[model samples]
Target: MEKKERKRIVLSSNTAFSLYNFRLHLMRTLKEKGYEVITVSPEDGKYSELLKKEFSFFPVKSLDRKGKNPIKDLKLFFEYFLLFRRLKPDIVINFTIKPNIYGSISAGLLGIPSISVITGLGYVFIREIWLTKFVKLLYWLAFRFNRAVVFLNSEDLNTLRNFSKEKSFLIESEGIDIKHFDLTLCKEAKKDEFAFLFVGRLLTDKGICELIKAFESLKKEKPKVKLIIVGSPDEGNPNSVSKGELEKWVKEGLIEWHGFQEDVRPFYCMANCVVLPSYREGIPRVLLEAMAMEKPIITTDAPGCRNVCVDGVNGFLVKPKDVESLYFAMKRMVELGDEKLREFGKAGRRLAEEKYSVEKIVGEYINLIEAVLSKS
Candidate 1:
């Protein structure tokens, strides 16, 4: 009889928060199954202490989530290579932009298996720019030796399929923790306010600007309606709105702005409906969280967004970037009556339990890892 050695898995992204919030369950599940899960990302003073408490956290200097600095990116790529040369992880899973591109290149250089998870085709894919061409070329190069390529939505899968050596897979979300978003958190007394909650980064491409416009319009029609904004302004992103603008919105009493909340349950509870008017998504985590909490949702009919919101079923689907469409959806929500909204909430919760539970998501990831390993 012998004890088999546990495989070491390295999970990487540009930001520690992305790994902390999205991949914890996957890490925990793999760890429980006797895999050593290590997190590699740039150090953050706010989250470094918390990250260190759980697993092996390796801080790399290469990640700049907002801007594209080629020298910094090259340095980050070398950082990954050097770290891999030292740590020698059995497998690597890279997320977000920089890590997926450069991390995969690092893994390929080391002759180690890697998986690239396309979380979202963000600002670059939103427009047909020279940068978009460069990004696609980089993606084509990085995934040369990847074990598997994963996409959160089909649109992105189709967009980048030709780049991957192997067939790409879709694991929309790793699934949400249903219990963490219990329906009991909904605040019934707040119904008179008819609050709408918008979560995620405060990037203009996330439809934050359009959301504000629609919210302003809705407010003129129904003064009691509330728009509660969660998440912080990412100054690093070119699409981010100015702090002065956010301050104006808050001071003028347009939105109840709560910046970058680690715990968003309170916001979900305080809302009658959740909204995300993003240009696109790779399946929105916030909308899934809202659904799990039995909060109705209103989102764009774009890739990742459409995956969660069912038009007129669990929530309404408006066209992306169309302020009037979003305005119409909001107005309709106010007129949907309380009982109908509640029904939407209930349907959303059921969808979360049946389709996007953490258990299901973790299992898929586990299976994907095991399947890849078995082939080797």
Candidate 2:
């Protein structure tokens, strides 16, 4: 009698879209290769259909952004433990904060093989030392048991290395689908008024406030310059910008806020440049998408953002949270006019093709997963 192949895989993450989009590709790809993929996330309407159609969905009560309660966190821990025991997955892949910490812990308890991807070290690690220390300890303990720890940026990989003796691997930003973000489809940008686009959760840590302040200041001198802000407030995130504050910016006519849109390519297409002033990132997907679209960029010189923009080449790099620096960079892009900006955009597209394409990144994930399975 032939022994049945045992290859049950589990993927856990807090962000619905992160699981649905980037990780979904992996799930489908793996399933096609004959592995059963189970997805765990905060059950939401957005993912219900896909879960029903494609994979086994496990609803886990997670701290959704702002609703952080210690009691609730405890509940989540138990929930994770229960799920792990029930699934008895041969391999587990965890992403984001809560999952990476609690999920890894649960997997360890069950003696399950696990892999964790450090997408970004969020607010907890970026703030005061006490909290940072606490979160670092969680990472140290949880990550120690994983088969592989994947980082999106070199700096993050180095940081993880500093904290522990574990060998960590690096991947280009959460892989962008090059075919989906083709530059050939982009309309020629306007020559007179240069458009600067900001996309991401409307969070303070993402530098939304700073970007708004800088845009307001620049508009005084360059009235013809336009600013477009995409993405909705992440109510769960502690650092999310208040709806009232964003409304005030719109009321003041400082910039155009498009709320949330399912498709971002049109916004990217119409813009001359992409800008992100985030305090930190684990390699922002927006920058990768913009570059894939052949758009010039302006972002802070912080670790992850720096990975995409080569100062003065593909785009300008400014100091994070420095309104004046961001404003000056915006002004300089305007001064460079359309031709120079197009050249920069062309360079950016080439860089994306060479370094950050989806094929390249997905290949890395495939290699990592195969290597882990080989050992198992």
Name the candidate that leads on TM-score. 1
lDDT of 1 at 263: 92
Q: Candidate 1, which segments miss by more than 4 Å at Cα?
A: 1-3
Model 1 residue 43 CA deviation (Å) reads 0.9
Write candidate 1's Cα lDDT for 1-376 as tens digits.
8988779999998888788888889988888988888899989876766778888999998678876788988998899999988988889999998899999999989988889999999989998999999999999998886889999888999999888735599997868999889978654564678899999889888999999999999999899899999988887778888889999999989999989888999888888899999998888999999999988899999989999988998999999999999999999998999889889999999999999999998898899988887775
In angstroms, give how far residue 182 of model 1 lies from its true place: 0.9
For candidate 1, the lDDT comes to 0.89
Task: Please list the C-alpha lDDT of all candidates, in the order they appear.
Answer: 0.89, 0.84
TM-score of 1: 0.97
Stretches off by above 4 angstroms in model 2 are 1-3, 66-68, 162-164, 188-192
Candidate 2: TM-score? 0.95
> How far is 291's C-alpha from truth in model 1 (Å)?
0.5
Give model 1's clash tally.
1
The TM-scores of all predictions, comma-separated, are: 0.97, 0.95
